[model samples]
Target chain A: MHFNMKLGLTLFAIYLLFYCGFVFINTFSPQTMEQTPIEGVNVAILYGFALIVSAFALALIYGVFCRPEEEVNSTSDPVATTKGDV
Target chain B: MIYDVSPTAIVVFLLFVGFTLGLSFWLGRKAKSSEGYFAAHGQIPWFVNGVAFAGDYLSAASFLGICGMIAFYGYDGFLYSVGFLAGWIVALFVVAEPMKKLGKYTFADALDAKFNSKGIKLAAGISTLAVSIFYLIPQMVGAGVLIQPLLGFPHWVGVLMVGAVVITIVVTAGMVSTTYVQFLKGGLLVVFSAILTILILNRGLETKSNFKELGPVAWDALETAFADKEIEILPNDGIWKDKLDSDQRDYVVSRNPNDPPGKITVWKQVKDANNLVRLLECQLLETRAGKRYINGLPEGTGEGQAQLEPVGSLSKLPDDKTETGPLGAFGFIKTIQNSEVKLWRDDKKFPSLKNGDKATVYYPKLVPGSQVLRPGEHPKFAGIRRDGIFDKLNFLSLMLALFCGTASLPHILIRYYTVKDAASARKSTIVGIASIGFFYVLTLFLGLGAMTSGAMDVSSSNMAAPLLAKSISPLLFAIISAIAFTTVLGTVSGLILASSGAVTHDLAVSFLGLELDDQAQVRLAKIASVVVGVIAIALGILFKGLNVGYLVGWAFSVAASANLPALVMLLFWKKTTKQGIIAAVIVGMVSSLAWILLSQDTFKSVYGIADAQGVVPFSQPGIVTIPLGFLTLVVVSLMTGKSKS
Candidate 1:
């Protein structure tokens, strides 16, 4: 539970940072409408920032929602850990 | 020194092929079970799998196409690089973990995992095959493109060689060998490309003597809205005779609708006995005729080597002449940005080539130090400048493909499965992003370097980067060209692997409900690989001279449309009914495909007509098709699945 919460918070923070960076640069870029010819590298960098944040955001969601590891005490039911698990 | 297509390069390729094939054999021995063969028991480490993602994703299109595009077309080609990389963000965020958790083996598995519906499987299987075949054409075409210069062989020979080698790789090993080979090639591609970038930086920038240059030769090509004319200009460099002569050179030129009308002046020449540059001027004339078909422009020069001020020292020459050097990567942009270079556009053509009787100027005179790249020099991006809202929408629609296609590619999706679990999937995706991102940055340099490297093949843009290398040193040229040829090898293997998996795992096994033994499944996969390999070879030959990147765009749109909706809904939407999945997959796949078949690309490329009349309103189908797919699934499932209660 703790790890999941921490992961979520970390992801949210990263997402915010990236979103802000994208917006800030986009707002300030004098000719964002001019397209990739003049500032091709910058356009790539901005989009990349957005993607990074989202990738991590999805990662955190997965981490938080995923079933945590179960204790082997449940293995008392021998059939549970048997070879036919598939 | 024009390096021999050295025995060393050939030996290197054969050795690489042999080693990889041997590895496949060993791995095949261990791949006795279905799970082992299809997914490697999901045991590959995140790091290895990540590089393999690069291996799978980079394909010949990424390496050869984008680099070549950037080499010749300037920033327009980099748009593809940007589009491809941008697509990955969608994959990393939306698709990776969900895809890993939902289903096993093929894309159809997830679509049918819930209701065990044959309809979903059948639709998805067909979609996979269609998309895979579309993707394969470009790789095969790339194989042919690289073969000509690399081995002094013809295009068809290259295509055949690639087919044979890739089949052996896939048949012997299946995904096991495919993954490792990708990992290996992926690493080498990045490393060598980085090395190439460093070399470019070291060479700095320079000009070439006017004396040593080659005429800008035009191949017998089909042009849209074209005319040919020539004019004379003063010799900018000392190489040309002071007066024009009709006897020496025969310059062939053509004008397209996107080009200016009258004949601008230019010279055709090789720079410093290496770089081939065309110095062009803006044409200003009205349906006028000119002399100099042979003189072309005897008093003037063709778009020849615009004085590359001579890099370092002129080879075999005394210290009497000018001493300059090659520019760093992106140096051409700087040369144009500064007053250091006065580059010309194509001068052999007219000033006002008409598109539907309207004046169209493809290359506008941007005096050196202008603040823009080639604005409408390329026909594909003409949408960027077309007046009215529809043009803007066209540009936006194309962007949609670049954005959505990455996240949805089946080959890229399967890489997430190669790693053990979802965490590894995420990690691997991150690494892939980093590696892919870095390479894209290098493309900007490699491309502009080729564009102004005074080494461009006007007849075939595919030849841009290799020809650029040839301009530098034949030895460096040989190594770079050979490496690029191997690039096709790495990418094609991955696409074949993905398609073969779809055949054995999705279509034959799941959809048909056919049971096969483990060994039998492996055999089926190998056979399927060979069959697909043969198809790719045939199509590659059929589609020569077409841009491989444009070919990949169709693949991206199809993959995005067909696979993405089904995969996403299955993972996230609990009520995504199996029948709904079936409908979504079929509709998404078919609609996007139908849209593409009726697209301008099909008109121009597949059917040798430039008529946009029969074409659909849009260039890329992903924007509409992807959303429509989701809607079809949601609406159908909501109406159908709920009523079952």
Candidate 2:
């Protein structure tokens, strides 16, 4: 497996957990979301901003860590392997 | 509110249109071949393509609709921003790089790359067209909505203008010009939005809803004026009209039982003993005779005519502070959380009218800052706040759709082909996520600012961002609006380009086995672009006044259901067959579309059939239809003897 695809999957999973936490809080523990731990900003606003910022952060991590285009293309599967079995 | 047409807006708007057209014409020479027309010959700079991604993705719905929603209903609109930006994770980590490696032009190309089957081409091509057309409607409607105030033109005129301009953009240079236009618009939108956010934070919070330059007058002074005998609460009678003088003290004008038919009761502004002011609500009425009236006067700001006054303001601040000095980002949010905002409630149906006259009233509703900051306040998501399982499911389905939908959208997917390779595509997507995410974060402030701007047009939530700009300065409003119009133009051109590619490349050439040359393919695509552009214009004009965000939500659902399952399975599942992809695409597309059409929302809004129950349990189909798509593909693949590749 290519290192880039593996790293991409890992970052994607981490972000998915963060995103799910957001949805779960909004859905179930909505009262917790209303709590303003950060002065005027509630958990909901803070969480929303965190999710957005984290997406870019994850993408930057992937961009920085992934192999260059030439190296990946040379060793990458012809079909460009993803998570599921082929 | 009266959207007074400004010469500044006109000049700025015309300059934007002219510059867009000029850019398209100048770049027209480069895209003479099919590769250039379809994918900019995979030569767009990664950075440019990334910003263009923002330009293409942040449609009128994201800018106008979401901000309007937030302004009116609070944090629910920002929830949409979170959902929308979250979709980029799927686009970047899963779809972008692989999509660059496999596809040549449209989304269909990637899906059909492994299987040279006509079924794949036909099914994927149809899905592309369906999603593109559905997405195009909101952009078109948003175009008209923006134009009405910016250029003083009617709705249809705005739709026509956007259609014509976008058609020229697509037909002239295709993806090359579209890419640059998107990049320019994307960059301006982000920069200006940041500047707007800064201005909002600097203006800080004020208790009084400042309309025009009217500062809060002392209650003691107002009490002295109201102490006159001219102050009287009159029952519905002709006597109320005689006392309706500006010099007189505040009085209540009750509805007259003997009032003429077709005349709706008006809400009059009156002062209470406490001197707490309740603003007069504006009503817009359209009579059967095609005449329009605003607040019982002809719809104009001329003598004897009435226009809606700008609304929305903070009724109370923390510590009863009349105003807070310039705030930081956290300070702004904190201030709003502790203050009370006066948002408007739109009442469309009034029973007083006897004739066939339609009336929409905009009245104020004061809500606590905490409730406004919380989710589930918007009517669309109000279900989630309730114990109803179906409503919760509806919200969940929409969130899921937004997460998956970005990767599947034909227009967005086609952008990968504009970049050179997997690495560039990855980088471009990263750039896209950064800009789009930053813009979305700014949306919260934009919405909250507009919520407290006290210059809102209660009639249309779509005008929040532009109207917020207007509250700042006319020049800023003009520039922001011009940028917004270009936002619509960039998105519509991308959709049109995607549609044309599907038609000429997939449906015409691949599905029908037409051996067309590169030049011929480009020509056919141009012709297809014109045809799709025309259809989009008509749909845009037709769907005017529908909430731009709702239509976009439906588009996302359809895209996620139809394309995502098929694309994902084909990418990862070696057992996936061409027949499986074909079946999945068709079923997913049809089912989602059917679910939307039959949903209770459609029953009320689209069909106008009150009291009619939808067949589906919920409005959004993503939760059901997306999994259904995957299941259908897997089952069909097993039955059809898989591993075609």
Candidate 3:
């Protein structure tokens, strides 16, 4: 229900959707994956590398938006709440 | 073909082992209490823990296995890299913070935080030990593989050595030593891999056409010999000399025979007018009396018997030149994309008399750069090219397990406890993702480089990265191998720690309600480490010669099936009862383990039975067992919901 959790889950969904599509297309249409999507690069290599890069990009985005607010945080307490939930 | 033990390798390996042991001893003094021994007293810096995270996760599978697969099978091997990195996303978003909040020492601590039930402790503890032990096998097996070429030791010796060293590391300092070892090795692995990739690009591609000058008689004779009776083939220049009993010949003969042979085989190398050796060739010398003959094409099993001289060349260049000299990273991929690569394909097998009992010959197949860069080249992924429904499901199942498995691995999960807090855990996961992602990208180039480096050993694909480094320089080879050996040590230490924590913290203290002092607990964990280390050594020696990455896959499947469903449901679904978690963990672990044991791959590979005799229809169990776990949890929770309330 929190904004950060929503953002995290949505981004994860988007990434998984693209990743699963790439995998399915490669499985069903093997010839299509073999075709060069860009000059000197086929669909499989292009999409596979893209998935790896996208993970870091998404992680950076999550880290930026999900920063813990200092006012609600306590440094002394070992189990301080971050943004929401417990 | 014989891998002679190099003095440089011995010195570097000794230095690495000495440094690791010395660090363990130094860290041991600080790890006196239970918290310090098990969780580093929650004192590790986020960055160091992050790098240590990479160290613990990379294992031998990512280094030796992925590179070897890519070297042999082209782009298909990089698929594992993609799957492995994607799993980190799951860890970063879903598991990192909650695990740090809930668990104290082991993965089971997190799972049983809400409900302090004996059943939860028993089930989750067993699952942790199972997954950790399964993960340990590949790391130990990889250690043996590395030792064979680096130390010229037998595989069992390598397994035993790794077991003793890892036990010493774990028992001495526990998490403190494990964290620092992982951090050190993790940094070295990334740096050296980058250097190796740079060297690969700088060397570019050159035609090593040593086999091209073989006279037409040799070719025709080989073909005729394959089609008809075994016959002697000679060079037209009449400069042939018997190279039998040589190291090259001896290496080829050392492999185990697939079947008995009825003939004697002789091999000779052709020399030029100047006495320079040009080509090595095999010939059937004679047949044994009253023996049945099985004849076809020469098998590729024998070393140097049926191999074409390492023959990789650039069929096309970006600038249409003979070679692209010292290209940039993008330029390297682009040139490889445009160029034709002579990838080796093992074609047929035939009985041999002179070489090993069978000779399996690999022919050089010139693949267009586009095809080589694409997936579906590996036999495990051949179903991707086919339109069969089962094949498609199998691929999807494997991907699902990999994506979910990262957060579920017991060894990876317990690292969160070593950090200070949830925020540190999250930050460390991010750092881990970045480092691991960068290393994986380099694997693409490293693998493709080895494929064309012409340094590939036709027999052991596991030696691809080290052999590629060897082709660049012997010193680099020694350093890379020593780093690889430490890579095994770091990962194996982490797994042993996780297994020991499960035994001492979750099972003994939580489940059995054992009251103990910190010293007593640390002592129990050390004993557990030794027991688990011995088990790992035995399994590693038993399962010799398997691809470490593939073995890691089975571990991933089991972890995803057994751990993920229970953890996810318990966190998100409030109605989840202790009974539900216990039932789910036990069912998931047992069913997946049984399914794997009954699968076709296991039947053929592990049991030495016909694959078709397997009870399970498919090899991977995640597609079936993962959902079964969640369903069992939901059903059991609902049935027990009223009683708990």
Looking at model 3, give its docking quality level.
acceptable
lDDT of 3 at B305: 32
Ordered list by DockQ, greatest first = 3, 2, 1
Q: What lDDT would each prediction earn against the true structure?
A: 0.62, 0.85, 0.78
Which is better, 1 or 2, measured by lDDT? 2
Worst 10 residues of 2 chain B by lDDT: B211-220
- Per-model chain B TM-scores are 0.79, 0.91, 0.86
Candidate 2 ranges with C-alpha deviation above 4 Å: A69-86, B210-231, B236-288, B353-356, B642-645
lDDT top scorer: 2
lDDT of 2 by residue, B237-347 (tens): 353344444424333333333443323334435454665544343444544357667646566665656566788899889999999989999989988898888778866
Better of 1 and 3 by lDDT: 3
| Candidate with better TM-score, 1 vs 3 | 3
Regions of candidate 3 where Cα sits further than 4 Å from its true position: A70-86, B212-321, B354-359, B610-613
Write the residue-wise lDDT of candidate 1 on B212-318 in tens digits. 22234332121211234322233222222222233233221332333333433333322223333343322222221432221122212335211111111112211
- What is the DockQ of the complex in model 1? 0.15
Which candidate would rank higher by DockQ, 1 or 2?
2
- Could you give the CAPRI-style class of model 1? incorrect
Every prediction: chain A TM-score:
0.45, 0.79, 0.75
